[model samples]
Each structure stands twice: as C-alpha cells, then as structure tokens.
Target: MSAEIPAWLALESGLVMQGRAVGAEGEKGGDLVFNTAMSGYHEILTDPSYAGQVVLMTYPQIGNYGVVDEDAESARAWPEAFVMREMSSIHSNHRATSSLPAWLKEQGIVAIDGIDTRELTKHVRERGSLRCVVSTTDGDTTSLVAKAKATPSTDGRDLASVVTTGAPYTWAEGYHESYPHELGRAFDGAGTKGGGERIRVVAYDFGIKRNILRSLVHCGFDVTVVPAGTPADDALAHDPQAIFLSNGPGDPAAVSSGIAAVSDLIGKRPIFGICLGHQILSIVLGAKTSKMPFGHHGANHPVRDLQTGKIEITSQNHSFAVETDSLPDHLELTHLNLNDHTVEGMRHKTEKVMSVQYHPEAAPGPLDAGHLFSRFREFVAG
Candidate 1:
C-alpha cells in the first residue's frame, strides 16, 4: 500500500476541510448535497439523478460490503465527487466484485474520506446545499475555495439530457429476486400476475434508473424507452398504452422540451412520472415548482396518502419540488410528505395522469411504496 495522498474540500461558504484521497487523483466540483441512506452507496453513485452534484453520505462508515456490478443503478457513476467520513479498506461481501475505492478509481470518480461528514451535512442543513470543490491535485485552501466559488450551479441547467440515453431501446428484464414471485417477470414465462396481454408503455428516459425499467417489466408493462429530447409525436408513434416520465437531475423548468412533450401527451395516454418527471408534470398542469431550501435526498422520508390515510416510507432524491399553492383545481393531491409538507404525489382529476416526487422503485430505500407500479398498471387497465 502506497502512502495515502492528502485531499481538500472547499465549500463556496469559504469553509475548508482536509481529508485523505481514496479515488482518482484529480479535481472536481459541484453542488454539495448529502444523502441520509445508510446503505446503497453503489446505487447512489451510479444514479443519474446525482449528476451535477457532489454526494456526501451521511452514514459514518461506508463501503463495508463493497461494490458489485448488480447493484449499479446506471451504466456509469454520476456524482462529480464522493465524500464520506470513513471509506473502509476491508470489504467482505459474497457478491462484491471489487472494493468501493477500487471501483471509484476504475470509474474515474474523484472521492475523499476521513472528513467530518456530520459537520458538513449540518452546514448544508443550516445553510442549504452549496457549490464546492474536491481535489487531490491542489493542496492550497485559497485556490480550492476560489474554484468552489466559481463552480456552476444546477439551478437552470438541462442536466437530464447530459445523462439520458441517446437512442430508443426495449426492456424485458425484471427484478433478480424470485421470493417476491408475484411482482417479478423473469425471462421464462409471462410473469404478470393476471396472466394477460402485457400493456405497452413508452417511458421517457430522463436519466432513468435500471431498477425502474425492471419494476415496470415486473408489473407487466412492455417498456420502450426513448431519449429525453424525443418529441410527443414521435413518442405517440409507439402506440403505447401509457407514458412514463423518469427521475432525473437539475432544474425541471429548464427541461423545456420535455415539458412540451408531456404537455402534448397529457390526455392522449395515461401518464405517470417520478422526481424530475413529477416536477415537469406539475408544471404542465399549471402548477409552479421552486427549489427547496435544502431539498429532500434520502430513502426514509415519510409520506401520507390523502385518500387512504396511510403513511409510506419512500426513497427520494431531488432539489426542486412542486409548490402546494400553485396546484391547479384540475389536479388532486394524492400524497404529502409528513416531514416538511411538500407535495409528494398527485394526479389529474379527469385525465389518466399521475406523478410522485419520490422513488417507488426502492433501489437503495424501503419497499413500502412499491405498490405505485401496480397502481400505474391499474390506470392502464382502466
């Protein structure tokens, strides 16, 4: 083992912290945000929704179980940099193919460890997420702070397009587990619960996660994924039974093309969206959205269903949310976050359109909200 290299983290607030370099040797900067999930660091790292940001795991000890190929949420890591209190060198897991730091280095993601993540997270909580820089190449605090201050924000950028798939593709794979036999569509038979013809769905890939596609297939939808820039007419050409808008990164208002596409497809098909998709859908429904103070980015958020009076713990990752006062009369509120009273879910009063601000796929979160996929299936059946 070579001697550990020193790294520095500088926030736009002029605060600087020193740590040990764990991943690639270089410099990177972005909006510094934190995730509270204790596990699923792999999923968080590969999640395209983390694009244009630096992720700080609130969990004190990360990488104990190591990295596995099957756990990746996307093809490549999306966070500009990774920050954690401790990056465990010894990893032991039956499915792991490589250690976390090794995998980060392989993916060319710059990372730092041994920093006081609790202090950093508290800073973000009190001051909101800030632009920051992480570097192993630069040891000067003044230089790193200057770079952090100069880092571009994701406020108005179309980051989804930066991570979206370039071409259309078909997905048939399902969840790897068989214990939950009712909700999984394996390669063999028609694994749908009802044993009927699968409903066709056109899913807009605005930085989609693989687990979402698997969840859709598991719920008996034949999914055809298209680029974020795909037009409504082109999507309608697929002759889908429903349309899905996926979770993504950055300001939803900046995704003007996606908003227009969803606007045209509103009444043509039953539509469902999550995260960035939820914001865009709300925007099309005459609702306004604004960036949250610190934003919600965790797996343990509690949401109450207005109709059922049930609270569901959900996985969420977003910086902007739909404004409650801006909700139009044509839409009805379906879910609200118990923590901060933010809009968690909603649906059209007449049209077959619905959306949620959290991840029901539960890649790195709980399975309490997985029924939303089935609910979408019900919308298609109706």
Candidate 2:
C-alpha cells in the first residue's frame, strides 16, 4: 500500500476543508457545484455542462462500482476535479476495465476524499455556487483562496465550442447498458426501428450525451449530428424529417450562433431541444432566461405534464431556466418542474417545434422522461 498524501480544498470565500488526495496529484480550480445522485459518477464527471467546474458529489461513498467505458457520457471527464467524503478502496464491477482512481489519473483529473461533503454542500447551497480550488500540490490556504477568487466567472462563456464536435457525423449506436429493455424500444446496433420508416434527422451537438443519440436512433431516426454553430440552411440541406437541439454548458444567451441558427430553423422543421437547447429555443422565441440560485443538478426532480396532468420524475442538470411569462402568445407551456414550478417543456402552437428543459435521455436518471423521444418520432412521422 502507498502512503496517503494530505490535501485540501479552499473556497474563494475563505473556507478550507482538509482531506487526502485520491486520484492524480495536481491542482485545479473553478466554479463549485454539487450533485446529489448516489451513483453514475462517471456520467456526471464527463458531462459537458460540468465544464470549468469542480464537482463535489454529495453522496457519501463513491467509486465503488469502478469506472467503465460503456458508461461515459462523453469522450473525457470535463470537471476540473472531483470532491467526495469517501472513495472506495476496492473496485468490483463486472464491466469495469479500470479503477476510478487509475482512470482519474489517466485522465489528468484531481480528486480528494475524506472531506465532510454534507457540510460543504450545505455551505454551497446557502451561498450558491462559487469559485473554488482543490489541490494536492499546494497547502497554503491563502494562496489557494487567492487563486480561486481570481478565477473568471463561468457564465456567458462559449464553452460549447470547447466540447462540441469539429465536423458532422452520424451516430449509429443505441443504449446497450444502464438498464433493461423496458422502454418497448429496441436497437440492433446499426439502427433502431419503432414501426416507422428510418426518417433522416439533423441533430445540433452542443455537447450532447451519447444516450440522446441512442434514443433518437432507437426511436427509428437516422441522426446526423452537426456542430453547435451549423447554419439553418446547411442543417436543412439534409432534408431531415425533424431537427434535434442538444444540451450543453454555460449561459444559453452567450451562444449567439446557436440562437441565430435555431431562429432561422424555426417554423422550417419539426424541432426538439433539451436543457441548454431549451433555453436557446426559448430565447429565440421571445422568452427570457435567468440563472437559478443553486441550479437544478440531480436525477430525482419531479416534472408535471400540464396537458396530461401526470407527474414524471426526471434527471436534470442545468443552471439557467426560461421565464414562463416571457413566452410568446404562440408558444404553449407543456411541462413544469413540480419542485420549483419552472418551465420544463414548451411548444409553438402553430409550428412543429417543441423543447424541454430536462434531459429525456435519462443516462443517469429516470426512464419516465423517455416517452418524449417516442413523441418526437411520432411528430416527424406525421
């Protein structure tokens, strides 16, 4: 066994928590946020919405199932570092190819364990998200705090460009793991079939999750994912039956290119957007957006379908939300978050465009929201 190295995390507000470095020995700093989910640490770490932030998992014990390539939301981890109360020393999972610590080291991510995450989380909840530094190399609290305080704000930055694909590509795979085939949908790897023709679909990738592509493919659509900045005419050139706008990081209004392109695509095709895509769509349609206090970042969020009066527990991760009152007369609210009564889903009355502020992909969340994908397919088929 190796000797445990001492470490510490210093918040920009001058609070310090001592711990031991669990992963790579390094230093990193960024906006601090917390996730309340008990599992799927891999997905959370790789999510592009976590870009330029240090994620502190509120769950007590983490890294028990180990790390697997099959569970990755993206190609690499995006968090500046990971914080936790305890990290499992032994990893035991059938599909895991590497231990979490080893994987973090390989990915050049710094992790710290042995801190009281509950207290830290409570502090963040009260004060809202703030700049923070977690380090294994530096122990000077004053210097670390100074560095954290000096870090730039993450809002309004074009972080989508940092994580989006450089060129257009087709996603052919479907959900192979994470749960059983209970959604009444099946994918044969190459494509999926749901009693409909293989409708060509254009997907705008503003840091999309793999399961979203899988969901579209499994719903019987041929998906072509273009960059976040792709123009409306270029996307329409494929003559897609529908268009999908993906979720991503940072302020939605700052993505000027996406707002402009989506604006042009409006009323041209059947459109569906999720998370950041939802915010962009709303902005283009004369709605307003504002940053939330602590932001929604969990899987157990309850959302209500206003049309059916049914409540669906969902998985969500976003810092900004669309103002319900700012919506245009043509836009109709479809879903609302039961926890905060925020806008969760919307659609233009006269056009085939709709969007949701929560992830229906359910990679690390719930399956109740999966019906939205099927509905999207039905819209395209009609």
Candidate 3:
C-alpha cells in the first residue's frame, strides 16, 4: 500500500517498464494483451476468455467508478494480471460494494498502476501480442525478462477447458435490471413474462460468460450448459431443439474435440456460435483459422451485416480468425468487420447453422447486436 514498494513489468521482447504495485504480491505473468474499451473493467476482468492473459487497459484511468456486483461476466476474475495507467485511489459509486484494489487482491490477481501503457499497447499493436511478466516482489529486469520469455504463449493452448464448468447445469437467470447491469448469481425477476414455451438449447460451455446465458434465457431458451468437449450424443440426450457454442480463450484450431463434435452436431438441429465458437464452427464447415496479427479486443468494433448492409457497433475479443479462403461452398458469409475487412458472421446455406465472431450478448458493451440472438431463436422456431 505504499508508493515505496517497487513494481516492474517485462515483455518477452526485452522491454521493461516500472510502476507502482497493488493487489496480490510476488510475480505473475501471462500472454500480454491490451483492451481499448473505456469502461467495463470489472466485466473484462471476470470474462473467462481472458484466462491465462495479462490485460492492459488502453484507457488512461481505471477504477474511478469502482467495481459493482452486477457487472461481472463470471463468478471470479480470470486475468492472470492487470495493468492500468492510473488506478483510482477511491471507489465512490453508490452501488459499488467492492473496491478495485481489495477485489483484485482478494482474487489473487497481480496489478500494476502508473505504467506507460500507451507505449506498451503500441508495442503490442506493432509487434503483436507477446508474453510478459509483472513482478511486485522481484524487480530485477533481467530475471523478469527471462521469466517472461519462459512463459508459454497462448498459441495452441486450450485455455477454455481450464475455465469451463466442471458439471452440467441449467441457467434460468435473465436480464439484469440493476444499476450496473452485471449478471449476478441471483434471479430477481418478479414474474414469468420472460417465460413461455422455452426452446430447449444445449450450450457448449467453452468458457462461457454469465451474460451469454442471461441473453439466451431472455430470448426464451431453456439452456443446459455442458463442457467444452461434450459430444453430440450426450447433448442430444437432453432433447434440445438447438445447440450453442460459446466464446472462449486461445486458438480455435487446437480444439479438435470441439471441431469434431460440432461437425457431427451440424444439420441435426439449429446451431449458433460466438467468438471461439464461431471459429470452431468455421473449422467444422471446412474453413481454417489463424491467429490475428493484433487481435480485436474492445467494446466498439464496427461490423456490417451483409444481408442488410447495416453497420453494428460490437464488442469483440479473440486472437484467432476464420480464413476467408477456407470457407466452404455450403457456408455463406453474413457479417464483416468494417475496420479490417475480416469475417464476422456466417451461416450454412442448407443447415440451420450460424455463427458470429463477436459478442452479441455484450455484457459490457452495446445493444446493437442483440437482434442476432432473436434471429437465432427464429432459426430454431423454423
């Protein structure tokens, strides 16, 4: 808690930056990545897709509004470490039950404030995401760099399996009407207005977020969350009308189980995928996936719907992308990222299967893409 305590961050490329330290002590490291979102620090921290990654906030100041219970995307923080230009000393929101510093410490996440994040983000953008180390106990640049270099990269890693739910369960919670709107463990709805003839959906929990489940429930789907490697027969045993693949961390190409499982599930029922799910679906659709030079991780990414030519401001987070050349004839591309002209959404021409490479349930982001969930429901109804 004193400014006298030294902290240092070291990149695999031999770049080192000094800063003030907070949260859990000792050294922590992960695949260094940056987010451009101005807010949603809590949601970003809790998102399971950030597992095994060190996240740097592009926004100058963080923790100004503090952390609230409603905004977490998962049960616990998943980022190995957190970096910020300035961490607020005081948390002042009326609804905030937790201070960012105490919360990070409690979660066992190493955090550094006052780091030169601008230069670090620029480095990642230009050189691509590199392994990095954040040390609060040891400040020796040489040792930190060595540790950073020793850290394995996210490439070929199946991080989703590590963060996935150990057992299958039903999710009935719906939209959060709270002040901050983060999905809480409690269901506070008063009536059954969100209820109806619930369409049964088998959701593949590839590090799924709570908001995605909330969105599914809001759309009247009775969701059964299964593990990342759940096969078609096990899922079909529940007699679900639809199948869903969730967003997650790491390379989609490495998930041979997911790809194989999805390949068998397609055409059997209506299916939908998001982020890593999208990439896996693409792989099963005879497409290839490769790591992006600098992956998209932000609240505001523009994607154009091919069918309507309308632009949607979306929240995105992923390191791998679908190769345009790898798409098969049966798959029809539906959305494209306006910034990089990359694939965003696609669907099988014949089967009731569709996927998006961005988060439509956007827990910490916009409502522009929410209609995609409705479309999926319609797809299932048909």
Candidate 4:
C-alpha cells in the first residue's frame, strides 16, 4: 500500500483529532455521527440516509472484507467522509474487487484512520451528533473547527429531494439465494407470482436502497419506484394496489411534499413505510418527530412486536423518531424499541396502513424482521 498521508479532524465542539488519511486527499465537513454495526462498512458508506453527514464507525477495525460492487447500498458513496480506528491494509475477501481505501479514493470519499474511535463514539453518545470537518490538505485545527461549525445544518433541509431518483422505474430483482423457490413465499424462482397474480406497488424513492426493492420483489410485489416529489395524483396514476414509503436523510418535517403526498394517498390503498417514511406517515397521521441524542445506527437493536409479543433484533439507521405522545387515535403502536422506549412500528386502527422505523430489508444485518415484507403482502392481498 502507498504511504498514508497526514489528516486532521475537528468537531464544532473544538475537539481535534490527528490521524492518517486513507481515501481522497481533500477537505470536507458534515454532521459527525457514528454507526455501531460490526460489518457492512461498504453498505453504510453508500447508504443515502447518511447524506450530509460524516460517518465514524464505532467498530474498532473496518474494511476487513474490502469493497465489492454487489454490496453497495446505492450507486455511489454518500457520506461526506468516513472515520475509523483502523482501516485494514490487507483485505482478504474472495469477492473483493478492490481494496477499501482504493475504492474510497476512486469514489472521492475523504477518509481517515488510526484514531481513537472509542473516544469519538463516546463524545457523540453524550453530546449528540456534532458538525465536524475532515481534511488531509490542511492541518490547522482552529481553522478546521470554524469550518466545521460553519457547515450547513441538516435541520429544515429537504435532503430527500436531493438524493431521490430522477425518474420512475420498475424493479424485478430479488435476494440471490441457493434455492429461490423453496423459501417461505410461494414463487416460481423469479420473485414474481407463481399463480400468475402479483400485487402492484408504487414505491416513493426517498433515497431508497436497492435491497428494499429486492425484498419487496421477493415478497411477490411488482414494484414501480417513483421520485420523491411525485404528487399524489401522479403516483396514483400507476394504479397501485399499495404504496410504499422509503427511508431517507435529513429532517422528516422538512420533506413537506412527501408528507403532503402521503396525506392524500392514505386510505386510498394499503400503505407501508420504513425509516424516514415512518416519520412522514406519522406526521400525516397527526404525530410529530424529534431528533434523537444519538440516533439508532446499528444492526443489533432489540425491538418488541406488540401484536406478537415477540422480540426481534433489527437493523436501524435513522437520526429522528416519532413522538409517542403525539400519535393520533387512528393509529396504534405496533412495536417499541426495547432500549430507548421509542416507537418502532405502528399501524392504522381502521385502514391498511403500517410502518416501521427500522429497516426490514436487513441488508448486511440480521434476518429477524424480513417477515414484515410477507406481512405487507398479506396486508395488500386482504
């Protein structure tokens, strides 16, 4: 590997850290947040929900498995920068097409390694997410701190519009499995319908993940992905049997168009949402959202399913959550986060509407909540 260059990071709180640069030799600033997942660094780096933020991995060692195109959650990496304790120099995965640092440079992602990630994670845990700057081209801590503080805040920003797809498209791929037809759902090995019938769904692409589309297809839905700003009439023009709201970045309240569209779409057909989508749905149903001290960004969050009285280990990556007390009478809390007592899942009392704050697709995580897709299928069919 080439010799690592010097890099410096400065939080708006005036905290400074010195490390070695591994990715692009440039400067960048964003909201500094940490993720606790032990793996899936590639997916985390590419997740559009991380837009406008600098990601610091809590896991001590990252990039052990290297980078592969098939593992990317989106077409490109979205984080403003990547930080870690030790980015492995020697990646050993058989599927790796390129080393982590090499790919990050190629993608123009500014990154730093060999730092006290533990201290950084603890700081964020106690003080909430902070604005920060990472620079390999500059070493002045005072200047970096000022730049960090001057970085634009994600609040009241419509980032969903920034990351959403440019046009509508159809998705038909599913989970690549050894035996596709033998899974829970009856399928003809192609993720379509075996009996020549399939539920048609229109999914709002609020910076959606590819795995989610694959999961929907695996559950037997023909998905049509539309842009985030698509109006209610335009989405309904697809004549969908159900509507799906996808996860995204930034303040949910700022996604005004999405909330308006969802408000008009409610009760017309079955609807399901995930992550930011859940927050948007709750807002339309008379609830409110607030940013968490340190948002849930991990694979091992434990949640309780109120309807089943079962605990599920879920994967979550959101900085805002629905306010429990603000929920309207028309909606029922379906799941709760065991750790923080926050709302994780909810459903309409009378309509075919439900949503979860965690990712059920489980990309690079556990399979505990994957059944929610089938539940949505049953919900649409009913």
Candidate 5:
C-alpha cells in the first residue's frame, strides 16, 4: 500500500483526531457533524445543505459502490470535508463512473478515512456540533486546534445564501419518469382529466436538493426554484399555484428575513417545507425552535404520521427542531419522531401550508414518504 498521507481534524472544543488524507490535499473548516447512513455517500457529499460543514460518517466501509452522476443531490459537491471509517481502494459497481476518492479530488473536497468515527460521533453527540478544521498540509496539531477554535459557529451564518443557486432553474417534467399503469387506469378527477393541468410550483431555494426538485416534478408540477433570499413579492409575481421552502443549514432564527417572507406568503398561497425550511415555517407560524443536543443526521429515523397513523423510516439531517408546544392553534402537528418524540411534521389548519422535519426526497434513504410530494401537487391543483 502507498504511504498514508497525514491529516488531522480539530474541533473547537480542543479535540483533535489524526488520520490519513484520501481526497484533495489542502485544508478545510466548518461545523463538524456525524451522519450514520450506511450508503449513498455520493448523495450525502453533493447535498447542498452540507455546505460549510465537515461530515463524519459513522458507518464503516464506505465507497463500495463508487460515485455516479445520477446520484448527485446537486450540481456540485458542497461538504467542506468528509470523514469516513474506511475507504474502499477499488471501485465495484457497474453504475459507478468514478470512485469516491477520485470524485472528491476532482471537486477539490478534502476527505480522510480510517478514523474511529464511532468515538468521534459520540463526542459530537455529547458536546453538540462544533466548529472544526481539517488539514492535510498542516501537521501542526496545536495551530490546527487554534484554527478550529477561532472558527465561528453556524449561529448567525447565512448558510442558505452560500448554497442557493444564483438563478432560477427547472427540472424534468411529470410526476414519474414514466406513467404508472395504475394511474393510467384510474379516472382523472381534476382539470383536463386526459393529461391534467400541471401544477405551477415555485420553490424558494435555501440549499435545495436535486431529489426534492425531482420529487416535485414527479408529482406533476412545473417547478421553478429561486434563490434563498428571493422576496415574497418576487415569488408571488410568478403566480405559482403553490410555494415550496427547501431544507438548508444553520439556525432558523438567524434567517429572520426569510421567516418574514414565509409569514407573508402563509395565507396567500399553498406552501410546503422540509428540514430548515420546516423550522422557518414554524417561526412564521409563531412557533419556536430549539437546537437538539446531538441533532438528527441519519437515514433510518422513524416518524409517525399523525394524519395517516403510519410510521415511516425517514432521512433526517438538521441540528434544530420546532417546539411542538409553540405551534399556534392555526397549525397542527402532522408527524412525530418515534425516537425522541420531537415534532417531525406540521400543517396549518386553515391555510394550505404543510412541512416535515425529515427529508421525503430520500436520496440516501427510504422513498416510502415520497407521497408527500404528491400531496403538495394535489394542494396546488386545487
């Protein structure tokens, strides 16, 4: 085997772990968090919400399938650094166009493997997600620790701006890649039964994932994704049948302006939100949010849908959650996490507004909850 390249990850709390660099050779800094998903490393790497963050995967043996263009959650990789337990030396999947290490190198992302991720994850869970620095070139552990300490936390950061697209864009058409035979046989109930009038949906891009957009498109919506800071009036100008708020990073309270915009658009249009978007929506609805001790960052979290009384295994990645008691009477809880009993979803009683704390797109997780997108389409179609 080649000589292991030296690298280290230092946290603001003065904790430092040494390992070998596997991707690009350089330095990276961000808030460090751990994800427990056993697969979909590509989607996790490309997820825009991971921007300005260093992700440590708890699952050992990563990169078994390699990377594929079709699995990317965004146009570019966003995670500042990646930490894994082990890196597969050889590519092993037919769908893989390139290996994970090669892809990370191409994207200029720093990564390290063969680390004790379980212990690291436990530390993060105990102390909370902290600012961290990853360095391949700098072996000075003391200075690296200082740098990590000097790094500002995600508290007031407008991370959404850093990840959102500069311009609006559209995605593939139709609710499915191909029409299902069951839908074909079912009678069309709404306008234009034959083809059905496509719902016009506008999504406020606060670090949106490609899978979310794809899910929207799959639900028979013509999706128009705008920038994170796009004004409510500008969104209204689109005359969209419904509005969507996407998942993102950092504190929801920090994005006060976006919350105001969501508040203004509440009764004016049908709305749906997820992750950070869900927190913002809660704030708009006069609800409060609090940071979790460890935060949910995995694909196997279970949430119970209060409306349907069904349990769904979900993909979650956020550090904050909406306070269930703080929700106004106008809004009602729609789902709750089975593990911690936190509010996982909510919906406005009068307005066509709904949100979920977990990802329904399921890029690196289960697709059982994808029906939420169809519900949004139905709300817009009305």
Candidate 6:
C-alpha cells in the first residue's frame, strides 16, 4: 500500500524545500511552524491549536511510538500538514493501536518526511512563521511557490470555523480512563461519588480537546460541549454552573462575535480559557492581541506563576498573545512565559474569570501545570 510520493513545501518567502510525501498523498496549505518537543507526535497532530498550520517537528525522528487512542487530545486528527526530518516506518509501543502513517491516512492529513527540519526551523525562527503549501501530487515547484506566496497568513483568518464542530455533541460517560503517574493518581473515584452534587459545566468548543473535557469530568463536573458560534445567551440558557472557553486557532481579533459573547458573560459566571480563549478574554476586557513572529509551538515551554513565584514546564501552541501593557485595570497577570516574558495567564479582579495561554491539560506535555484545573474547579464551586 505504499507509493513513491514526491512533494515540495513552498514558503511565503519563496523558499522551497523538496521532500517525499508519506501520509494521504495530496496538497495542503497552511502557516508553517515548528515544534521542539522530542515526543508526543500523536498529541500534537490531534491538537486543535494546530488547526491551520503545517507543524514541523524540530526533533528529527518522529512516529516511533505510533498512535494511541488514549493519548489523543482531540476526537479527530487536526494538523492540516505535518513535516518532519524522518518518520519511523516501523512503530514500537505496547499501547500503539496503529502507526502514525496509518493514522494520518485515516484522517486525510498530508505529511512530508526526508527533509532537513532543523534548517527549516532555523529559517522560520529567523524569518517568522509564514504561509506555505505542501504539494504531493503536484511537482511544479514554481506554481507551488507562487501559491504559497499568495496565500494569506494567520493574521485575520477565522480558522476556528474550519476545525469546530457544526452541532453540539455529548460525550458518553466512561470515555475517560484513569492513569497513575508521578503527578499522582487521577480519576480516583471514576464512577463513585462521595457526596457533593455534580457540577454542570458548559464548554464552548472553539476547537476543543477531548482531554480538557475529560479533565473537567474527572474533577466531578458534568460537562456539555457546545459549538464555537453558540451565543452567550443560548449558553446561559443551559443553566451551566461554569463556562469554559476551549483552545483554538487563528486570530482572536477575527473572532469578534465570540469576544463580544465573552464580554457579556463576564462576571456573570465562572469562566476559564486556554490559548486562543485566553486571548479572547483579554480582548473582552479591553486588552489587545497581536500575532507573534514565530509563535510558541512546543511541549517543553517554561511558564512562571507570578502569584506563587514557581516555574512550571508547560505545553503551548499559539501564534497570538494578549498584550500585557494594554490590559485593563481590573485584570491582573497571573502567569508569564519565562522564555519571552509574555503574558501567559490573567484574572479579572472583579469578575469570576481566569485564563491561561498554555495548555494545562497537557496531552503531549508535562503535568506540572495541572493545578490550574483545580483552581478553575474551585472558582466554579465558589
């Protein structure tokens, strides 16, 4: 079932890298970005945060451990395109249900291997993330380069619609299983409840991850996930005890309607946001958002909690960040990215709202920041 697939990745800067296609031989276009994590290719591929981007893994060899059902962050694979130096043809892992190549074919994601990813990453780091096209069927580098150059960047694109579900869906119970790790045992009481009533939580899916909902449900919250464009009034009609904004792709400024909805719900109910959700909250609070040159797209990012003065390694995937200088008086900065000193987390002084720019659920990253979920749970309980 293998075919000799020729492909070329053309960047907006007119730089073209020739390679061979591995998964779902086709053409795909997106903003090209790189990740530095040595592992967790499956989690990264399924992460909705990478919706409109062709993810390039800086760590050379990928797909060694293969794909596992339990490790999937989202319900479906989402990377528009995947780039790596080399993809392991033979997967080796006890929990692996299928190889990465097989999983990509099933999901219809275009992937490229046998390219120097480090050089490409270095190029992106110096020139910033750019729109690019990965073509497997087409070998005309000139036309591909032209198309890549003409493609619009992620600046004002409303890519959330592309990745979000069209209708509200309910996750059946028992979807999440517990695991014991260094962070301690999770889901101690899976089916049994001690005493307190189940907290009803309404999550607005602007490209949500399965892990986030699982984490909330594991914390005793009865979760109901809604679509991205669901109106604030409509969400409140559900009588949810808390509101959650899921991580998503594209610009926060482009999601003006969602920002407005969040503004209306501010101070009305406890709310928590991640990644793009965090940016939207800041925009609702009169702060501004700007696109990063290269952006952060890795699992080993370091973020310092200003309140506790403790640094936690986190998983991050975003191209836009909330401008700390433009934050309103009521909002307080809670976390800072130690690498770039960017605003990572914020809380409203007078409102029951808090958000973080990094993924605390950590599908492919560290669990050091899992306490943020506990903080959100406490906020909802109060």
Give lDDT tens digits, candidate 5, residues 82-173. 99889998888877889988999999999998789988888888887788999998878789999998876677777888888898777664
Q: All candidates' TM-scores?
A: 0.97, 0.96, 0.95, 0.96, 0.93, 0.94
Candidate lDDT (C-alpha), each: 0.91, 0.87, 0.87, 0.89, 0.84, 0.83
List residue ranges in candidate 2 displaced over 4 A. Answer: 185-193
TM-score between model 6 and native: 0.94
lDDT of 2 by residue, 1-382 (tens): 8899988899988999889999888899888888888888999988888887889998999999899898888999998999999999998999898999999999999999999999999998899878899899889989989988988657878888778999999988866855556654423322354355787899999989888988887878889999999999999998888899999988898999999999999888899999999999999989999878778888899999998999999898888899878998989999999988999999989889889999888666777878888888777667
Over 1-382, each residue of candidate 1 has an lDDT whose tens digit, in order, gives 7999999999999999999999988999999989999999999999999999999999999999999898788989999999999999899998899999999999999999999999999999999879999999998989999999999989999998999999999999877762244334222343275576798999999999999998888778999999999999999999999999999999999998899999999899999999999999999999999988878888899999898999988899999999999999999999999999999999999999999999988676777788888888888889
Clashing pairs in 3: 70-182, 71-182
How many backbone clashes can be found in candidate 2?
Answer: 0
- In terms of TM-score, which candidate is stronger, 4 or 5? 4
Clashing pairs in 6: none
Collision count of model 4: 0
lDDT of 3: 0.87
Q: How many backbone collisions does model 6 have?
A: 0
TM-score of 3: 0.95
Q: Residue-pair clashes per candidate, as listed?
A: 0, 0, 2, 0, 2, 0
lDDT of 6 by residue, 216-311 (tens): 766667788888888889889888989999999999899866887887888788999998889889998889999998999888989999999999
Which 10 successive residues of model 5 have the least lDDT summed? 183-192
- Number of backbone clashes in candidate 3: 2
Tens digits of lDDT, candidate 3, 1-382: 4555678899999999999887777788889989999999999999999988899999998998888888889899998899999998887899798899889988999999889889999999889879999999887889999999998888999888888888899999977676233222112321235344678999999899998988888777889999998888998999999999999998888887888888899889899999999999998888999988878999999999999999989999988899887898999999999999899999999889999999988766876787787778778888
Tell me the tens digit of each residue's lDDT in model 4 across 1-382.
4666999999999999999999998999888888899998998988899999999999999988899888778899999999999999689988889999999999999999988999998888888879999999889878988999999868888899999999999999877653233343522232354443678999999989998988888778899999999999999999999999999999999999999999999999899999999999999999999988878999999999999999989999998899999999899999999999999999999999999999988667877787888888878888
